[model samples]
Target chain A: MKRFAFFPGCLIPARYPAMEFAIRQVLPRLGIEIVDLEGSSCCPDPIYFKSKDKLSWLAVAARNLSLAEDLGLDVVTNCSGCTATLSEAIHLLEDDILKKKVNDRLGRIGREYKGTTRVRHIATVVRDEVGYERVRESVVRPLEGLKVAIHYGCHLLKPSKIMQVDNPDNPQVMERLVEALGATAIRHRNWYLCCGKACQTEDIPMNMMHDLLTTVKAAETDILGMICPTCFSQFDYGQMKISKKFDEVFDIPPVYYFQLLAFAQGIPYEKLGFDSQRFKPECLLRF
Target chain B: MPEDADRDEPVRVNFRFRRELAQKIEGNLASFCYQCGACVGDCPATTYSSGFNPREIMLKVLYGLEDELLGSESVLWQCTNCYNCHERCPQEVKPVEVIISLKNMLAARGIYPEVVSKIIGTFETTGRTVRITSAIDRQRAKFGLPPLPPVPMDEVRILLEPDTGTDEEE
Candidate 1:
C-alpha cells in the first residue's frame, strides 16, 4: 500500500466522520496508505492574515506539518482549506528569510520546519501518483448513469500557483476522475462558482447564503462531487439552508468523488461513509 | 476602523493588493491604472448606484492600500464577485478573484459581515462551511448507510495513524 501522512483537518472527522471511515477502507485498496498526524489541530482556517497573527498561524501550521514531517513523510489532505493553508505555509517557509522568521517563532514550541516536506491535496496525489488509468482499472462498479457536478473550491484553484493541479477556468481532472468511477461529470453554471466555502462568518454567511444557493440550484445536478471538506460542508450542508430559504427541495447529496470510487469498488455504501452526509440516505438515489 | 476616543496616527498596513483581485477586474487594469477614463467612464455600478465604484476600489487595491483596500464594507463584497470589470477593462484585469480574495481575507480576519463568521465557525468545528445541526444524526437516519459507524468525538485523534514524528530508538 502507498503510505503517506493524512491530515483530515477539523471538519471531516468532527462533522463528517463517515468520509474518514470511507477513506481508510477505500484508499488502501488503491495502493495508498494514509498515516494520521497525531495531535493536529485546525488549519487554523487560513483567514488569519486579517487576524494579523502570522506568528500564531505559522505556529499552528508548523505544528500540524511537523506532525507529518516528523513522521518522515509528506502530508496529504482531503480538505482544500487544510491543503491550501498547509501548502501556502510550506511555500512561505520555503523562503530563507520567511523561514528564519517563522522558525524563530516555531522554535518556542520545539519544532523545526526543514522545508523538505510538501502538503498535497488528495486530487493531485490521485491524478499524479495513482493515475487515471489505475483508477479506471480499479473500478468494479461504474456510475454510468450518475450525473455529477464537480466543485473545485477556490482554495484549491485560486492563486493557482500553489495548488496547480488543474485548469481553474476549465477543469476536467476532477470530472474525469469522477468519470473513471462510472459517473458522469456535469458542467453546471456554478461549476467554477464559489459556495463561499472558507469565507465563513455569521453575517457574511447568512447574507451570502442566497448567492450560495443561487449557484447550487443553478447547477441542477444530482450528485455534487467535492474533493475538499470545506467545500463539502458549504456545498453539502449549506444546501439545507438554501433549500429552506429558497422554498425549494433538492435531492442533491454531497459525495467525495473518491467515496464514490470506493462505492464502485463494491465497498458497501455503509462502509464507504455515505450515512453522514447532510441531506439523507435516499438523497443519493438521484445519482 | 477606530474607536471613538483613542485616535492614533494613521496606521499603514504593509501589504499589496492581491494582483489576482485587480487583474480580475477593470480598475487595476493590468495594475497600470494610467488615468484610464474607461474605468471611470464605463462603470455601471457607479452609474446605477451613486455609491458603487469599482474604479476606486481597484485603484486602491492596485496602489497597495491593503487595509484601506480591503476595508470597504459592501463595495468589494457588494461587487457581486462579478467579472464585469474585467470584461470592460481596456487593459484586461481579472479583479473578480482578487475582490474575492479580499473578501475571504476579511472573513478570515473575522471582519466580515456577521453571518460569515457563524457559518465559518460551524465549518471550523464540524468540517462544514454552514451547518445547522450535527450531521451524525443524519447518518443515523439512513437505513442503508454505513452501520455502527464511529461518530467522531472532537477530542478523538482523527489524524491517528502512527506518527513518524516520534523519536524512535535506534
Candidate 2:
C-alpha cells in the first residue's frame, strides 16, 4: 500500500468530520494508507488568514509542511483550501530568500522547512497514486443510474501554474472518478463558477450560489459531488439559506466525493455519517 | 466642466504603497496588468456585486490608489480569491494575488472586518481556525475515527509571532 500523510484541515474535522471518516474508510480499501500528521494546525486558511498576513500565512503553512517533511512523505489534504495554502506556500518558498525568511520564523520552534515534501489534494492522490481502474475494481456496490454533478471548488484546480491537478478550464478528474463508480458525471453550465465560500459580502455569495444552483437544478442531477469541505458546507448548509432567500426550492444534496466513493466501496450507509448533514445524501442509501 | 478640470491635475501615484506591495509579492504583478477585462469576465464577485471589479482594482493598483483601495469601506473583501483571474490573465498579472497583498496592507493598518479579526484570534490561540471542543471528539467517535489531536501551539505561536524588524531588511 502506498502511504501518505493525511492533512485534514480545520473544516472537515470541526464542521464535517464525516468527510474525514469517509476518506479513512475509502482510501485504505483502494490500497492507499493514510498516516495522520498529528499536531498540524489549520492550513491557516486560504482566504482570511492569507489576506490578513501573507508572510505569517506562509510561515504557518510551512510549519505544517515541515511536519510532513520530517516523515519523508508527501501530504494529502482533504480540503482544497489547505491544499492551496500548502501548495502555494511551497511554490513561493522555492525562492531561497523567502525560504530563508520563513525558515527564520520556523527556527524559533526547532522546526525547519526544507521544501522536501509535496502537497496534493486527495482527489489527485486517488487519480495519480491509485489508478481509476483500481477504484473501479474495488467497488462492490456500484452507483448505477445515479447522476452526479461535480463542483471542483476553486482551490483544487486554479492558479493552474501551481496546482497542476487538471485542466482548470475543463477538468475531468472528478468526472472520470464519478464514472468509475458507475455513475454519470454531469458538468453543469456554471461548473467553473466558484462556490464563493470566501466572499465576505453577504449578497455576493448568496447571489453567486443562487446562479450556480440554478444551473445544477436545471441539469436535474441527483446530487452535487464536490471535493472541498468548504464548498460542501456552502452547498449543503448554505443551500438551505439560499433556497429560502431566493424563494426557489434547491433540494439537491451535496456529497463529498470520498463519501460517494466510500458508499460505492460497500461501506454501510450508517457508518458514513450522512445523518448529521443538513442536506443528507439519502438518495445514495437507496442503492 | 468640473470633471475635465479634475482630469487636468496630475494623477499622483503613491509610489510608497506600490513599492511596499512589490516587496510582498514577487515582481509586483499588478504592474503587468494591461486592463484587457479578462479577469472581469469570469469574476463571480464582479458578476454579483456592482462595486467589486478586478479590472478596476488593478487600475487602482497601477495608479497606486492606496487610500481608496484600503479605505474603511474597501471592496477587497468582496473578492472570492478564486484565482480564476490568475487563469484568465494573458499577462499573468494574477489580480487575485495583488488583491490579497492589498488586503494584507489593510490588515497591517489595523483595518479589517470583525470576522477576520475573530478568525485570526482563534488561530493564534488554538492553532486552528475552528475551535475544538469535547463535542468535536464525540463527532469523530461516531464514525470510528480517532479523536482529534492537539495542535503544537508552542510551534504555532512561534510561527505567528510578530516580526521583530527582520522583514524590512530584504
Candidate 3:
C-alpha cells in the first residue's frame, strides 16, 4: 500500500471528523495510507490573504511545510484554502531573495525549509490514484438507486487554477466518482455556485440570505455531495435556514463522497459517521 | 456623466500590475470595463454590505480615488472574489480585474494585514506551507490511536509542490 502525509486542515479534525474517518477507512482498501500530522496550526486559510505583510503569512505556512519536508513526507491537503495558500507559497519561497528573507526569520528556531514536499487535496487522490473505473469495480453495494449532485467548492478550484485537480468551470471528477459508485448522477445548476461560506464572517446575513439561498435554489436535488467542509456547512447547516424561510419543505441532504463509498462497502452507518451528519440516515434511506 | 466629464476635470486612478502577479491571469480584464453599471447592478459584493462597492470602486478608478481605493480594506478583503460581477457584467467590464489589480497593488505596497507579515517571515525560514505529524508515534496518550501504517510523503510533495523543488540538476 502506498502512504502519504495526510492533512485534513483545521475544519475536519474538529468540525467534520466524519469525512476524515470515512476517507481513512475507505482509502486503505485501495492501498493508500493517510498519516495524520499533529501540532499543525491553522492553515491560516483565506484570512491570511488579508494580512498586511505577505512575508509573515509566508513564514507561518513555511514553518508548517518545513515540518513535513524535514520528516520527508509529502502533504495531502483536504482543505482548499490550505492547498491554495500552500501552493501559492511554493512559488514565493522558490525565489532566491524571498527564500532568504523567509529563512532568516525561521532561522531563529532552527527550522530550515528545503521546499521538497508536495500537497494534494483528497479529490485529486481519488481521481488520480483510484481511477474512476477501479472505484466502479470496488462497489460492494453500488449506490444503484441514489441520485447524487456534485458540489465542487470554489476554494478547491478558484485562485486555485494552478494547482487544480480537475476542471475549473465544468468539473466532472466528482460526477465520474458518483457514477463509479453506481449512482444516478443528478445535474444541478447551483453546483457551480460558490458556497459563500467565507463571506459569512464578513456579511453574515447577506452571505446566507442571498449568496447561499441563490445556490440552494439552483441545487434542485435530493442530496448534495461536497468536497469541502466550508461548502458542506453551507448546504448541510444552510438547509435548516431554507426550511425555516420557505413555504414547501426544502430538504436536500448533504453527503460526503467518502461516506457514500463507505456506505456502499457495507460499512455500518456508525462507522461512516452517519449520526454526526446534519442529514439523518433514516431521512436518506427514503431514497 | 459624459457631459459632466467633458466639463468637469476627469478623475482617473493609475493602476499598476504587481511583480508577483501572473502576466496572463485575465486579472487585467478591468481594462474592458466601459463604466457600465451592470456590475454595480448585480454585484452582491458591492451592495451586500456598506462601505464595500466594486462598482463605486470602479467609479473611483474613473474618478481617481487611487490612494483611498488601494488603502481601503472593503474594496479588496471584503469581496468574496466569487467573480459574480464578472459573470453578470453587461459590457464584459470585469470588475474582478480591478479587484485583482487593486489586491496586487496592495500586496506590492505591503498594505495587507499583519498576518501576511508573520507568514512572509515563516517562508524566509522554511520552504514548505504546512507541518504533518505521524499518527502512530503516540501509544499511551489519548491522542494515541491504532498505529497507522508507514506513510509516503514524497508523492504528496510532488502533487502539491509540483516541480517547486530543485531536481533538474540531479
Candidate 4:
C-alpha cells in the first residue's frame, strides 16, 4: 500500500467528521494508507487568516508541511482549503528569499522547513496514485442509475500555477471518478462558479449559491458530488438557508465524493454519517 | 478662461501604500493588468454584488487609491478569494492576491470585520479556526477516529511572534 500522511483540516474533524470517516474507510481498501499527522494545526485557514497576515499564514502552513516532511511522506488533505494553503506555501517557499524569511520564524520554534514534502488533495491522490481502473475494480455495488453533479470547488483547481491539480477551466477529475463508481456525472451550467464560502458579505454568497444551486436543481441530479469539505458545508448546510431566503425549494443533497466512493466500496451507509447531513443523501442508499 | 481649464487635476497615486503592498507575497501582481476585464467576467462577487468589481479594484490599485481600497465599508471583503480571476487574467495579474494584500493592509490599520477578528482570535488561541469542544471529540468517537492531538502551541506562539529577529541564533 502507498502510505501518506493525512492532514484533516478543522472543518472535517470538527463540523463534518463524516467526510473524514468516509476517507478513512475508502482509501485503504483502494491500496492507499493514511497515517495521522499528530499535532498538526488548521491549514490556518485559507481566507481570513491569510488575509489578516500573509507571513504568519505562510509560517503556519510551512510548519504543517514540515510535519509531513519529517514523516518522509507526501501529505494528502481531504479539504481543498488545506490543500490550497499547504500547496501555495510550497509554491511560495520555492523563492529562497521568502523561504529564508519564513525559516527565521520557524527557526525560533526549533523547526525548519526544507521544502521536502509535497501536498496532494485526496481527489488527485485517488486519481493519480490509486488509478481509475483500480477504483472501478474495487467497487462492490455500482451506482448505475444515480446521476451526480460534480462541484470542483475553487481551491482544488485554481491559481493553476500553484494548485496544478487539474485544468482549472475544464476539470474532469471528479467526473471521471464519479463515472468509475458507475454513476453518471453531470456538469451543470454554473459548474465553474465557486461556492463563495469565503465571501464575507452576506448577499454575495447567498446570491452566488442561489445561482449555482438553481442550475444544479435544473439538472435534476440525484446528488451533488464534490471533493471539498468547505463546498460540501456550503451546499449542504447553506442550501437550506438559500432556499428559505430565495423562496425556492432546493432539495438536492450535497455529498463529499469520498462518501460516495465509500458507499460504492460496500462500506455500510450507517457508518458514513449521513444522519448529520442537513440534506441527507438518502437517495445514495437506493443503489 | 485659461486654455487648461477643461482638464481635470491629475489623480495622485499613493506610492507609499503601493510600496508597502509590494513587500507582501505577489502583492504587486496587479501592476501587470491592462484592464482586460477577463477577471471581471468570471468573478462571482462581480456577478452578485454591485459594489464589488475586480476590474474596478485593479484600476484603483493601479492608481494606488489606498483610501478607496482600504476605507471603511471597503468592498475587498466581498471577494471570495476563489482565484478564478487568478486563472483568467491574461497578464497573470493575480487580482485575488492583490486584494488579499490590500486586506492585510486594512488589518494592519486595525480595520476589519468583527467576524474576521473573532476567527483570528480563535486560530491564535486554539491553532484551529473552529473551536474544539468536547462535542468534537464525541463526534469523532462516533466514527471510531482517535481523539485529535493537541497542537504544540509553544512552537505556534514562537511563529506568531511579531518581531522574532533572525539574529537570535540557535
TM-scores, chain B, all models: 0.49, 0.90, 0.56, 0.89
Quote the lDDT for B15 in model 1.
Answer: 40
DockQ of each: 0.08, 0.78, 0.12, 0.75
TM-score for each predicted model, relative to the true structure: 0.69, 0.96, 0.70, 0.96
lDDT of each: 0.60, 0.88, 0.61, 0.89
Candidate 3's displacement at residue A193, Å, is 0.7
| DockQ of the two-chain complex in candidate 1 | 0.08
Docking class of 3: incorrect
Put down candidate 2 lDDT per residue, A71-97, tens digits, no spaces.
999999888889899999999999998
Ranking by lDDT: 4, 2, 3, 1
Return the top candidate by DockQ. Answer: 2
- What is model 3's DockQ versus the real complex? 0.12
lDDT by residue for model 3 (A62-103), tens? 777887886688888877778876776776677886687667
* Segments of candidate 2 deviating more than 4 angstroms: B1-7, B167-170
Per residue, candidate 4 scores C-alpha lDDT tens digits across A231-264 of 9889988999999999999989888899899999
lDDT of 1 by residue, A1-287 (tens): 66789887656765666676677766777788887666666665664331323334555576677778788998988887777678767876766865775566556556677877787888888888888888889887767777777777666775466566666677778887988887778776646555554432334444454554556557776677878776677666777776776677755777776677777877766565566567554544443
Q: Rank all candidate structures by their TM-score, best first, as comma-separated numbers.
A: 2, 4, 3, 1
Worst 10 residues of 4 chain B by lDDT: B161-170
Better of 1 and 3 by lDDT: 3
Residue A80, model 2: lDDT of 89
Q: Locate the minimum summed-lDDT window of 10 residues in model 3 chain B.
A: B155-164
Q: In model 2, how large is the Cα lDDT of residue A287?
A: 96
